[model samples]
Target: MPTSICKACARLMKEKEDFPRGNFDSDYCASCVDHKGNLKPRDIIRVNMIRYRVNNTGVSEEEAAEIVDNLMRSLPAWNKPKTPTT
Candidate 1:
């Protein structure tokens, strides 16, 4: 079986259900994309991740925020350099 990591949430995608719209070519997971297969805003994903961690892992909100921040920074989607607007 092939596996891929979601660029937005770091979710391990081992099955078709794990990918957004069940598309294996997608770099993000279902949780990270909208129904149209567009990636959600970074802040939205960040908040969702933090909430998930706090609820599932029994972690403090602050701790989850910190952990998510570090994790997002290491992810390809969030780690890329930002471009300046013209």
Candidate 2:
């Protein structure tokens, strides 16, 4: 069986797993994208979302920091990547 890594969140998935119909050549994993191939606003993948918000929004630095803080809180307490036990 071939394993695939999500382009956005780096989550591992089965390559033969069914992907939503569109995005014919897309390399993203289902958790990172929606049925329409749009990035999902999930805590598991909040890093890029926060960056995009801070860079593209008109909010002040303080507000941006607060937003980032919120996003940080949304993440699980232990987010370290999964590793196989020896």
Candidate 3:
């Protein structure tokens, strides 16, 4: 097999390397990977947003709400939860 190169920066891609590792490879170099690992924060948020939308596909509102609830439950205490009142 031919050594697949990064389309972005034209560098050789090694096994278990690079980010956004799905169908499309990046143009970043190995040095760039070292300098700036995987996805940026904004990019990560964007990807998560895309994933969230994709996961919502065919899911009901109640199911989506439950998913959000579960995610909230798993978060750290820095995030405050709403308390129930009498």
Candidate 4:
């Protein structure tokens, strides 16, 4: 199996379940997209990451937020400027 990193969350995608709607072409991951396969808002992604870190790793909320913020800033999706919708 091939592996790819999610542009939004930096999660390793190794199987169909890792990609949004099992889309191997998707740059993001299932956790980074909605059920309709649209990329979620940055704030929502940030919150989800922070929450996951805090709950799963027993990290402080502030620390998790800091880590998640830095991580998100480094990701391709979050680093790029958003274009206005027509």
Candidate 5:
């Protein structure tokens, strides 16, 4: 059996253990899937992971929200230039 790499984390995957989905084994690892038990865009996963970390810690709601906002800004989703569609 061949090993495949996770598109997100670059973790090695084994064929028997790996469940490939969406265009033949370009799938993310089980650990990389969304908390809701489904696939999500990479940016969403990145954002949610940070938010989940913030929530897990004993932080105040207002502080956590602020932190998460800053975290998202660090990813610069809004800073990227827009692409023109044909």
Candidate 6:
């Protein structure tokens, strides 16, 4: 039998998994499915920073502090990648 490979993670699947009302088809494995399910921390940070900046425009200090705290709790999932030398 021919197998379908995921374009994102390149995992093979035998058939499409079906939902109750519709079909949610994918060639990726379960791990890849779970991995892509949520936002990366950096991405969350980037969005929250924008939101905080907008919400803090001449706002109350307490509100601004709250926004900053909410943004800070979303950090620490990423680190700079190290380059390999020949």
Candidate 3 local distance difference test against the native: 0.41
Instruction: For model 1, name the residue pairs that clash.
Output: none
Please list all clashing residue pairs in model 6, or write none if there are none. none
Stretches of candidate 1 off by over 4 Å are 82-86
Off by over 4 Å in 3: 1-55, 77-86
lDDT (Cα, tens digit) per residue for candidate 4, span 19-78: 887889998999999999999999998899999999999999999999999998778887
Over all chains combined, what TM-score does candidate 2 have? 0.35
Give the TM-score of each candidate.
Answer: 0.88, 0.35, 0.26, 0.87, 0.34, 0.25
Off by over 4 Å in 4: 81-86
Candidate 1 least-lDDT 10 residues: 77-86
lDDT of 2 by residue, 1-86 (tens): 54555545444556545243433355566656776777666554565545556679976666866776664443332233633322
TM-score leader:
1
Candidate 2 lDDT score relative to the true structure = 0.53
Q: Write the per-residue lDDT of candidate 6 for residues 28-73, one digit (tens) a residue.
A: 3333334444333444444544454567586665665576556444
**Residue-wise lDDT of candidate 5 within 1-86, one digit each (tens)?**
55566544444677554444432354565656654546666667555555665778867656766765665444422225532312
Query: lDDT of candidate 6?
Result: 0.41
What is the lDDT, from 0 to 100, of the residue 74 in candidate 3? 38
Better model by TM-score: candidate 3 vs candidate 4 = 4
Clash number for candidate 3: 2
Per candidate, the number of residue pairs that clash is 0, 0, 2, 0, 0, 0
Which scores higher on TM-score, 2 or 4?
4
Give the TM-score comparing model 5 with the true structure, all chains together.
Answer: 0.34
lDDT of 3 by residue, 31-59 (tens): 33343445233334333434554576766
**lDDT of all predictions:** 0.89, 0.53, 0.41, 0.88, 0.53, 0.41
lDDT of 1 at 48: 97
lDDT of the structure predicted as candidate 5: 0.53
